[model samples]
Target: MTNIAELRKQINYHLYRYYALDDPIISDAEFDQLMQTLRDLEAQNPELITPDSPTQRVGAEPLESFDKVTHVVAMTSLANAFNDEDMRNWLGRIERRLPTWYPRDAVEFVVEPKIDGLAVAIVYEQGLLKQGATRGNGLVGENITANVRTIKSVPLRIPATPDGPPPPTRIEIRGEVYMPIKEFNRYNQQQLDLGERVFANPRNAAAGSLRQLDSRETASRPLAMFGYGVGYIEGAELQTHWDALEYLKAVGFPVNPDIIRTKNFDEVLEFIRQWMDKRDELGYDADGAVIKINDLTLQKYLGLVGNAPRWAIAYKFPAREATTKLLEIRCNVGRTGQVTPYAVLEAVNIGGVTVRQATLHNFEDLAKKDIRPGDTVLLKRAGDVIPQVVKPILEARAADSMPYQPPTHCPDCHEALSHFGEEVALFCINAACPAQLVRQLEYFVSRPALNIEGFGVKISEQVAQAGLIHDVADIYTLTKTQLLSLEGFAEKKADKILAMIDESKHQPFDRVLTGLGIRYVGSVVAAFIAHAFADIQALQQATQPELEQINGIGPRIAESIVDWFSRPANRTLVQKLRQAGVTLSSSKVEPTAPQTLANLTFVITGTLPTWGREEAAAFIQDHGGKVTGTVSKKTDYLVAGEAAGSKLEKAQTLNIPIIDEAGLKKLATE
Candidate 1:
């Protein structure tokens, strides 16, 4: 009597809308309430749970060749230990043997949500991230170093320990990289808008995104990773997984904060139960719980069994799976120079929001799902943010399904794109291209740029189209009527814009330099450049010899600086800017005294008592001391302030001198 067919159809339609469309009509709480009711009904009547039901299993055929990778140290998957009885039995088995296995010395167990994603091993040599690979049966994996490099959270260069020792001379770290629900949603939405196929869930999305042939593509997807275990470390020592996570964070990798250390197995169960109930709140999909012996030494004693690690276990969450059609495939380009591919869905609703799109990452992704524009696909939402396409239903594919193509040119600017030999991004190198110019102009006129209030993108475009302003400096000379004539610019708005332009003249010399769109010249570098040269004219006239003396300005940036100034048009543009009354001089005096805080590197910790961090740093730089972020033996002093955290302990451990507000003031005077 249960109308399973009708209910299945209704649920499928709603799922498609939520996961594919991104526009949802129902509240998450309401949707979950309905889903719970349906699940309970299905459980009561097992015959009613159909393949098409929302509670169905995640579908995807296994892949063929995961490129063979030899981990510096083998990357192993964790063995499973589910439920209280299973956990206690394993703990007894471990305690029955090992010499260092006393209950009190057991320390606390580290419990984390078993993030459902691909396992990868990252190797760092001498504090530099060198390689990353997947766990292909634990002993070997496919090298994905390049793709892993695209993850911004993964530090390219590890921060040196405060104790004057670099990070382990050789270290192999194991972790899981995942896609957050919010980023996945945005990624899928972008794909949907571009008419691409969508990903089904967070796990699939993360796996598919990470395995990309083009690491660059893998890098662009909203993929995040957390270091959960260590494979091998030389020189440096960590006692527990919690400490390892902290160390990873210190070295610039983002670690999940939800990881907890509990003294008892009941506490672990409570943590799991609590998290399972609150699973929808996590940004990434967690299938189960990952329970590990917190102590690294304990982990070593209980080491490898087959392809799994004996020290840890994964308790996966109940799976939520759904099937939908892969309507189309598309690509998106962001402001930060990343091109992401996504899928346009047949309008599914997963979680509370309607999903119409899912990200594909790049050209390399198209091959992974074997995803064609018109194929039926299965999907799942891990933490309810990203919709990942699992695999194409080959048997269900329409005859018209075809492979997707990558664009040869920049969609925003018609310029021919060029890919750097070292990078996967095909850059539109023409800085003067309409789109790049427009973006740069927008940035230049931003509060941090020229600080012109009324000069927004649309206004800038109007000016560009009208041929009134070709360069950033031209914005300073626009007539009030010229702006007033544009679509949204009224007399008052135009006057306001003009006044903002006038105000921009007073922006510091460093801000003006940054607004010029010099390659690799950000705000901090701009400040350095301003301080390096006494004025704009001096910077322009300075030889490479003089320019190379500034710290952080390497050969490439130095070359770029010289080339920028050498261009006749650029010189003429500067002259025009000067004519327009832009200030290109700094008021700060250069300290010429020997040993006046010279060569003394200081690290600023937490919020300053009386000054903004930057202001405090500027105070140090003005007095000839360099301000760095982390504590190190190279650091002359640690300026500790209110709410100081790990860096404080690091300074203490390394015996680096710690200074307070009064001490900083004294140093400045000395």
Candidate 2:
């Protein structure tokens, strides 16, 4: 039998690789096998399970409230330097405070991106994570150890590597916890698809995700950390700030790889300029560049002025906001019947981009902001993406302005708008509403759905306006002659679009399900439903409870699925799609081969070399295996590929066997 301690060490190392370094040596399935063995051993010998074991990352109950924790060393804020003049002035101030022995111009400094996130201090005692707290008021914070442990990048135990330095008696690692931009966008999209309020920006999303009372919820969120500095340290001798960062990295903390050490302030200025132009390229949000004195002794000598450090300054990028007057507020109904309120703004230049309109998010947010017509509003364009109205400048509000009211009728179709139970936004529930039909057609041809080439938002709108395509099924009825009649539809373009539309008929049933625009049934959920039922007919016949029994399908999603199929129009559309020769079932027919993986469960993650996750999962199911979204003791294998995240970590910790595409193929043959 494998030693439990050795298994734990191996799992932690792989986690550090997958999370901290963004690299993994083994597939998820192989890792799960290791975890399962360890779990079996620990289950049989309960005393062998330790706090630092990987299994302890999750499974904590929700807390009613957090307890206050006082910091040994205050997590101070940094002084701001907006320009070269400000930087020079700050350097001069630091020089004046330094002793004569320290050469002012020769002092080394470290420059790193100032992450826009929540600051938290992680305390490690005897090499294990002891406590984690937020930097509330800089002096004291709420203890969030359980939630922090759920962050895969944050190691539960320090000195995780065998060759690493001995355990520190105690240390407080201070870092910013943030959600990567990609993950934030994905999460916000999920929220929108579910008819929930979306986060305004990544920073807000990170803060909200971190402060969840349920650690399980936090674990579900894609949160990561980058250690920048230490709050307190005992037992270790750190000579300089750079040395401390190196020590943190050696002990399994992820430090930003873009950090640079330089003695020249000119280089620092250049670095800041480069980052200002390239910050969007980074995975996480960065609002500024932090320049700190590299020497620990010099930092101590030039320490605290008020609450900010004298030896360090943050060179903030110019604000991406512009003040504009709210001309009016209007609502737009989406294909899914979701109604969103937006602000019509007097044109203002934000980050060199002209902003004519901004999103107000929803009616609830609009009422909360108390924004009215003729009020001055702050509009921000973070990363030059979508522009959003921050808030109304109450002082600049028109004296006669009244509180804005949500529309009682659909903006486009003029039908009565209705709000769903427990939902914030109003919806235009009429399926035949022209606006809804147009948007729904657009979604049907979207990349994640049927992926009809040459079919874009403008094209979908034109086709709908011409009465060529009213519903997703009507798309197959379009003729090249009808397309050529529309503006901008030449012979070549029309022919190409017709060909693409024909090509989409072969799109798998899962994507067809997604293209149906069922509420809360995005690609992930659609795939689960498609796999569970094998065919659209089976899915349509499934009861709400039967749908909910699928791993990823919750009560709300199951209800949505059942409600959608219950409608006569939807059933007819599915029938039309089938009549049009569209694939309405799994492409892989039930295999006659021996059920090699019978009664076994597998979880798939990341991108495979030759097959997509869905393709690989379909193969497993065809061979009599079950696929689930999460890894657990019940999971027999985890099919992992490149860039696997939390699932990979969890599999490794549980000692579950992991396999790659090749390994999976081998298992299928056996």
TM-score top scorer = 2
Over all chains combined, what TM-score does candidate 2 have? Answer: 0.84
lDDT tens readout by residue for model 2, 1-670: 5688989999999888888778789899888777766665665567888988888777489999989999889888888989999999998888778799987677999999998999999999998899999999889899999999999899898887557798889999999999888988888777776677888888998899889999988988889999998877899888889998998888888899999999988999999999988877887788999999999988898879989989899999988888989999988888778888998989999777788999898888889888888899988877624689999998888789999999999898888988788777899888778888888888899999999977999998998888887678998988988998999989999989989989999999899999999989989888777786557876898788656557789998989989999999899999999998999987774747567877677888766899976688878878867677767787889998765666778999999999999999999898
Model 1 scores what on Cα lDDT?
0.69
Tens-place lDDT digits, model 1, residues 1-670 = 3465555545544443343333456777777656755664564466666533555422223334346777667666667765677777877766676674355555568888877778888888886677778887767688777667666445554552222245779888778888877887777655543224457566778889878765545645877777776777898888888888877755545567788898787888889888888888887777788888888877777777777777777776655556688776765544333445678899887645577887565666667667887788777665655566767778897787677666677776666777655655456555455655566677788766677876787887788777787777788778987887778778888888788889888888899998886766767678888755546886787677555656557676787789888877679879988999887755453445333665677777765679765566666666766665556666789988765667778999999999987788788787
- What C-alpha lDDT values do all the predictions have? 0.69, 0.86
RMSD value for candidate 1: 19.8
Clashes of each: 59, 20
Q: Which ten residues in a row are the worst by lDDT in model 2?
A: 36-45
List TM-score per model, in order.
Answer: 0.49, 0.84
